[model samples]
Target: MDDATVTAPAPDEDIDLAYDVFARSCPSRHTLEHVTGRWGALTLGALSENTLRFNELRRRVDGVSEKMLSQTLHALERDGLVHREDRQTNPPRVEYRLTPLGESVAERLLSLIELIEGKMPEVLAAQHRYDGRRPA
Candidate 1:
């Protein structure tokens, strides 16, 4: 594992139940935000399929600027959810893939994405109804 990569606790270790995201000081909250952020979500989803080059990821994500994509990748890397490999060649090549931990989270994220997308029509209808009832 990379020096920055965080490993999961061993099965025999005790888990901390007080590490609550709602408390605002939990470290997990920071990781949760990074994983669930707009660009992060899309980037992870794209990488879940296979390793991808920077430009390929940008294209797959759609509408993400090069700078934003870079930042998002860096954040995910720091959080140990993404693995970046650099191949030193004449033209230079870098590819991104999910680590084992990342793959686990990405699967769950994909499921959530499917659920939200499936209910989008209902969400839109609710929004319309709420908006229509408001005074002009």
Candidate 2:
């Protein structure tokens, strides 16, 4: 569909304001999965810096195969969180960047990642203690 036809989910109708993600049919669950999936998070994080070409993004994300990256980008693009620009040129250059909404989400993800990294030592220690209690 064209850009004009694309629309965000309506606040009042389609997505219930009181929807619980724990429920099987909640639309938020699908959105959460798309935004927080391994490649999705990384892709958003990488694009938070600036626009990047396909290969540049692939390299930045590290270990994500081309197919997976493409899929992640497509999902983000469909969600209106990522902008894909095609520069008409001899070689068909394309670049990806986070939309404003995407930047907001990416910033949140970066903060969460930082918090996890800061607590990793404590988490690892807890894991070690838990593992120790298990019978061999």
> What are the clash counts of all predictions, listed in order?
0, 0
Model 2, 13-53: lDDT tens digits are 67624556677666666778889999999899999988999
- Which ten residues in a row are the worst by lDDT in model 1? 1-10
lDDT (Cα, tens digit) per residue for candidate 1, span 4-47: 43445767989854455665455677889889999999999999
Instruction: Name the 10 consecutive residues with the lowest summed lDDT in model 2.
Output: 1-10
Candidate 1 error regions (>4 Å): 1-18
Candidate 2: clashing residue pairs, number: 0
Scored by TM-score, the top model is: 1
Q: What C-alpha root-mean-square deviation, in Å, does candidate 1 show against the real structure? A: 5.9
Q: Which residue pairs overlap in candidate 1's backbone?
A: none
